[model samples]
Target chain A: MSETPGIPAPPEEPSEEQASRIGVDSWVAETERHGRGRGPLWQLARLWEYSPDPVKLLAFVALASTVPFWTNEGDLFVFGLFTLLYAALGLGLNVVVGFAGLLDLGYVAFFGIGAYTYAELSSSQYGIHWPAEATIPIAMAAAALVGVVLGFSARRLLGDYLAIVTLFLGQAFVFFTGVANPTVAGKGLTGGANGIPQLDPLTFFGYQLTSTKQLYFFLLIVVTLLATALYFANQSRTGRAWRALREDPLAAEVMSIPVNRLKILAFVFGAAVAGLCGTIYAAIETAAVSTNFSVSVLIIIYAVVILGGFGSIAGVFVGAIVINCTLEFLEPQNDHPEVKRWLFYGTIVLLIALLKPWFRPVLVLAGTIAFGFVVHAIVAATTAASWTSGVPVSGASWLARWAVIPTGSHGNFNNYLYIGLVVAVVCTASLKGWWRMIALVPTLYLTALVWENMLTQNGGITAFILFGAMLIGLMTVRPQGLLGTARVEIV
Target chain B: MTEAEITATEKAAPPAHPLLKLDSVDTYYGQIHILQGLNLEVQSGELVCLLGGNASGKSTTLKTILGIVQPRNGTVQFEGEDVTSRSTSYRIGKGIAIVPENRRLFGPMTVLENLEMGAYLHAGGAKEDFDRVYTLFPLLHERRRQLAGTLSGGEQQMVAMGRALMAKPRLLLMDEPSMGLAPILVERSFEIIKQVHESGVAMLIVEQNANVSLSIADRGYVLSTGRLVLEGPAAELREHEDLRKAYLGR
Candidate 1:
């Protein structure tokens, strides 16, 4: 065969004619004559041509706007502030479960480490309080080191084995925090189970982030930054290598991808994000408790990742927002508060066993919309009626009614309306054409505004109830997630 | 003359250093010795096919060359360099690519992705390589975005071949490329083998289909129980009546 100057021969020509085209005399002149590379725009255009979907630029803008008002509200701002932080943590776990296919059972330990790091360095634990700004970097660095240790263990172990080790790591952190009494060294260094109290909020460029609304905006910015960074990381060569490793480790190794290094990077990345969340949590909550970083938290975060979809960044965000909002808004009817806990966890396990095996997409979407509306209505009705009645809220009866089964309060009707709109928006998005996705903006805005209202309220039955409903919706309609699509690869 | 020039002149360029040279390479699967002291070589641009019985270790010979199986003793050399201790990935990194039997395409990935994965090691030059692959197999180009698993057996084979080409290997190793295909596909596959050899890459192929293997092979080796029983030019191997009677269908 006559060899081409620039083009080599095809490995599977299967014919003489095919071989001749590839085996040309010279391709340099031919390639040069084509004259490509106009500018960055041209490069972007070329990429757009190859990619599956056009980028959603509007979503980025809306999410960006939320950061400004995150920490400004009073007590109501606390939930938004924490939600932002927790969502950031979820993104970190996304790298482990989504990108790397590593199941971490002790993710909270990293979060705990961040809290402890912040607590010890700041006024909460130690008398020698460092500036709040300094704690962020310090906490992140410490968490990264712990992540590396976890990564080393992950390289040598796999599947359930890694999960078992991470579970122990979580337990170890809890045990250390619970038992270690370092009063001899300093006044508030360990803080015991009471954790750190009166930890200071972050101050940026002379701007104070003390209120819940202001903190919410701050956290929103932080989570957005983390999510964007993770998105790019997933798109890069390193991220591709991680995805390949997840799909098939042996084959990935054979391709010279350095499977071990990629796994560790994922571990450290996830830990760093978790640590960032902890730093924010300490600032927002004004106190930290061991139970806040308990095993249940791990289960909930894992549920978010799994229910959303593995290897999807968008899915993680959607999962976090849906799960957090529902948990915030819905509570059980007040009469039987005890029943709510069983229902909350039971739904998760049942969905995993039964619904997840089949019809997962349908179930998850339906449940998300349902939960969103239910929480919206309940919270709205509760707030509007309580305000109009000028009723001084009685504590125990309200709790009982919220728990056993919500009796009709003015808030309950609002909850129903909220749930209805949520279902309608989800329906429109799922079934409509391109125009509908564009049109979903107003609906999402309304939903978010209502969502923020319910979340800002102190822990309520409507929030828990909505969360259960959303869980059911997520399990049924879109097991991949509320806003996520299933990814199918051809062999 | 200097020693270097003297040696170069005396050996007729030393036959291009046998793009692949396997010397007494032994391989085993746990207790079973699959390949016992296998020796083989293929010069640059030469098309050599190893012919063997069902359990004669032909497949294992190719696997050993690819470093999928570690050789217990002796050396496996590529381009005059010993690669016995190298990992499979290192072998691939050194521009060695393979089309394993049954076409182990990543079932979930598209044909294009599979081909792209072949050039996974290339990093920057994938688009050029992709265009080159598509030019050779227009059918593959048409179905480039189609899942490799969903394609017919023939299309899947094209993906396997395109993926190997993506690596731009100097030596291509193929194991049973014509394995369960229809007779027509088998003929088509042989043509591909010949074209690939003509593209400046040396080839070492193992096959039970001796007639087709011998047709494209410049030189051929016949293996029986991990030992070389026959070696000759392709024409001579095709005419070997005793070998034909026993192994190839008469």
Candidate 2:
């Protein structure tokens, strides 16, 4: 099986048992869909497909080359923009995760910290507001300081223990944002729970970027410069030490790789990327909310990394675009039904788990068509529901009330839900065994209900149920996730 | 008690200074005192074979020179350079490399990579050393790309030797290179050692096969209970009546 992040590679390649279920023709067709010759489209496809190191490097260059070409609000441009940002994050993560082999689940916290730093420093509420350019360096320095603090203790821990501590640190950041109530700790630094707002935009020499389209292009340039710097850093002696340590710590120490020093450097470098991303987020969104730095965002970042494949730079960029854009498209508004979107996530994951090499392309095409259909259906159904409910056709109904489909009209979301479940089941069965298909039930349920709760109510009982189901689903079947590979260690 | 008396006694005994010396070296694994004040030495230009039964501290002595084993309460000196406090890489840089007991070649790496790592001490000037290593073991150049783990025992020993030579060490410590080879392979290995000796690298080889080790070794040390029981020139030790009776099986 090809290596995917968080997912274990299938112990053996698909056997006759697997081939017959997913069907050899479908597998072949899917493989062909993913394996076309390289151009712009091929580069986008390669972002999703698992490739070797040289292929990954080629993909990075290809993505980097496309930065200048982003000019519109088209899907590809938005995707390319997200890709550059995530690629930056991945490079930072590569230091801690790839080079050091330290599992850091709370990496997003550092990114958030960087973002918040910029938000606080540049926002009007801070009273000592700086330009965005100045904030970028300050945020980076703050992130590095956090990294040093984490590193001081991180050296003593490894694997699961390190993960727990980092996780705790992430939890602490979330709690602190709310617990303190008002942003600053008497320093009046942050705007507190409301978070910093009205942050400064970036300027190149004298030309200030006022448009979203322009900002995207500016981000593209920053990503290119950073990627080049990271590439050279990876080639340097320090990078070699990181690789050596990743390969074997004891052996590296014996070779005089300066184990502790390298570990600290990796953490600092990884944090710096988070800092840079924070700065970018501050300028692009023009707001910094605690909600923006939530656990969900971290999960999305991880999803990108996992989808792209761990220890892969290009994979991260490709993964970021694919994951973030998909999530964005799915959650068009709160009224968007959870069941349908989750069904989408579950089906994609199932395909990856069972028929990985075969189902990857199938899901991509299938998802695009399904998403377009769902969006069209939601728009029509919600618009009709508003008219029938006897409520005046207001703009608020467009945002929230559409999901209910009104009181009197027989708006059948059940039918759509059933269709989604059936599609998920069929896709799961086609890829592998019926036993594995059983594993999708909870994930599907969670995906549905969680979105329902988030859109309709304040994280009601349904959210708890979904969370519980997800926990159970994770315990069995695809513990590594559908698209991720398990890590192998040799003692 | 006078100075004259002490000088006279010292004159009567062997020279105290050793080319490679371990004095009162106490080694332990947790609570187990594996080596109890082990004292030993090797003279310069001498091909000394450490003879011992299993667990008799033969391999451990070689480990001391390679800086793999740290002596808890004693000193390890190589040509008057105190090496007890130095690291393995430092020792390798200081011209001490070992062909370890199990031939611990980097299994995943190729024979060439393993050899290159052996030259890790002098990593930058690798091309210059490569020709020398290949010359010493031409068979290695042929099997250079082959994974070190998959090679046969005899071939592995050659790669191990070539790897050690890549470091250009003055003292080569070999631990049981003939442990699991055919009789012919064992003889060939011994011949290779003789060739290495002629090439002027001081060797301290450890072996359980007393007769074979004693034959090629310029000098021999018989160890029992971590204490040196016998030490003399190889031929003289070979002819010793007690040695011939116990080790040579004559």
Candidate 3:
């Protein structure tokens, strides 16, 4: 009579019913004696749990907080600035989706609102100049107010309907900012496509945060303070209530947790955090562009939050660091293609090394190598040397003879190879053990061929490809992320 | 009283001025009607059982009374006050507690935390309630720090009962407490339920095993296909010919 579908009914299985027939207390005793999640990954999870939190936090802070000093401004901006920015953004999102169990697709709208409000107050576009202290608070308050209003209006809607409403609201925010920027005093208020620029730099107590290093330190400080505050808050009653609401809203409401009020409070907190990040973002870039807060960026933040482990404060940092660094690495390096090329080969090697059953990886590697050379030799012998003359990417010249990269008109000829490669990869996922291994041999070869031909030509497109691959890989491997505990849900 | 003694009673009417009442309740899940014109009542300090086969709207009645599901056209009253439109929490605050089906323990939380959650409205932190629960189910105290998910089915059931008791409710609602338990455990659990019932709280228990529930229940109601078909003292209902054919597997 229990509504939970996945719970095993006593009489459904003979063994269980027989166990129950023996005695009730013994069954419970037997269950306690048995192990849960008996696997290598679960063992690793145990080990992770045994490690102390402060020790891990200190190590992470040491690695992250010093990034601006060692790297160039470009690297610092790419790796340091954006990474921390996204971490803050991701943590904000974790509160709503992970803690409060609310599907707020309109989260980015608050972030956008924070940026626009700050820009309007501090930038030349509006001819207003509020100090950083005043502007940031006002922006955050405005965003929180918006979040409360949205939460109050949508109180009756739950789950999927809530998601749809927030999703539409997000789209409306984009349209209003990008195309529907109403004209005030004979000028477009939001600057339309160009966006509002010439924003004031972050100034504190008669000193200006002019350099990337200063901004990085400021951000590092803010992130640490916020993370600490969130940690304390999570230890309080509010966090427990939020988690209870997330687990089962109906149950929580009945248990006297005040579900609706808690949901709205979650939104307010999430919006405030997002608002802070948005103002800082505008300050860092000296601009607030509508294009900056597009749906893609929203997805990126969601991916980061999910990857780091929902509801985990530390996980968001880890997610942000991994994602932002990878995205930065894939940025167009016209003068230096070695980074992308090395990254591609390194990934393949890593996958091969991690392949299960030890010998299967060796076999797959040997097969891919043999398959490449045999085809290359046959192509060269049958046709011209120029037909198989193209080289491997970067300085890996020894690979040139075996890897068949067509010279001149390196065109849609490889398009078929790439398409086949996609199909082969997808097939490998769906195939069983032996068939998957068999498919992998061709899939590996095709991947190399595709990369050498099409993927290497444009870092822009490959960035997305790499992101998609990483997200899929993370979900399949560890949905809990770096520091999150695995949860069991009723089906 | 022994089974032999129970059969001696043929006429037992419910006490006047029942503590809770559902009048002509009609519930629907989108299109299909569930609890069709269902009327039921539980007297103050009485242990009542609602029995039915699957999809007979047994669980639906509990949900309706708890406000988890709203009846289309009916009134549910608690102590003479209409509670049909009240929120589930509001009803709970008014001395109603439910042991939701399958225990529904917050799996990640420790047994202690789960009990604490049951007393969420208790600002004084329910130390006395916790002690009372521990006294009733000492195994819960032994496994107070253990995660509810790791516990066996029977132990999880105990935790659920202990959790509901922590609310210190005047009325308790349990859905299939005997489910997934061995026969011996069911008897032991029923003993505990009898103790709780004797301690002056009214109870409304929903079950598929009519015989087991009716053994301890003061009175019984049989619901089939969203309607009550029989009602009487537990001793009389247990011997009812129609109930034996459909439920007792005789």
Separate DockQ for every predicted complex: 0.15, 0.10, 0.25
* lDDT of each residue in B1-250, candidate 1, tens digit only: 3446535644675745777889988888888887777778788788888988899998788778878788888899988899999878789889788887777776655566667667777882367788877877888887776656567778788888888888888888888988879999999988877877787888888888888888888888999988888877788888899788976768
What would the TM-scores of all predictions be? 0.69, 0.65, 0.85
- Per-residue lDDT tens digits for candidate 3, residues A80-146, read 9888899889888999988887988988988998999889998788688888888889999999999
Q: Which scores greater on DockQ, model 2 or model 3?
A: 3
Q: For candidate 2, give the lDDT of residue B176.
A: 91
| Candidate 2 segments exceeding 4 Å error | A1-80, A145-161, A164-186, A233-238, A287-303, A332-491, B1-19, B42-70, B98-125, B136-166, B172-250
For model 1 the local lDDT of residue A397 reads 36
RMSD of 2: 10.6
Pitting candidate 2 against candidate 3, the one with the higher TM-score is 3
- Evaluation by DockQ, superior candidate among 1 and 3: 3
What's the TM for chain B in candidate 2?
0.87
Stretches of candidate 3 off by over 4 Å are: A1-48, A334-336, A355-371, A432-438, A477-485, B1-18, B23-39, B54-56, B71-74, B123-125, B142-146, B180-185, B198-200, B224-229
- Taking the tens digit of each residue's C-alpha lDDT, what string does model 2 give over A232-308? 77665566556556655655544434577778788888888898898888777787766777777676676666566
Q: What's the lDDT for residue A108 in model 1?
A: 93
Q: Compute the lDDT of residue B121 as modeled in candidate 3.
A: 80
In the range B1-250, model 2's lDDT, one tens digit per residue, is 3446536743774454456778788877677677777776665666889887788788777766667678788988877778899977777777676777766555544677666666654642367688887888988887776666557778888887887887787778888978888899999999998888778888899988888888899777887767777776677778889877776789
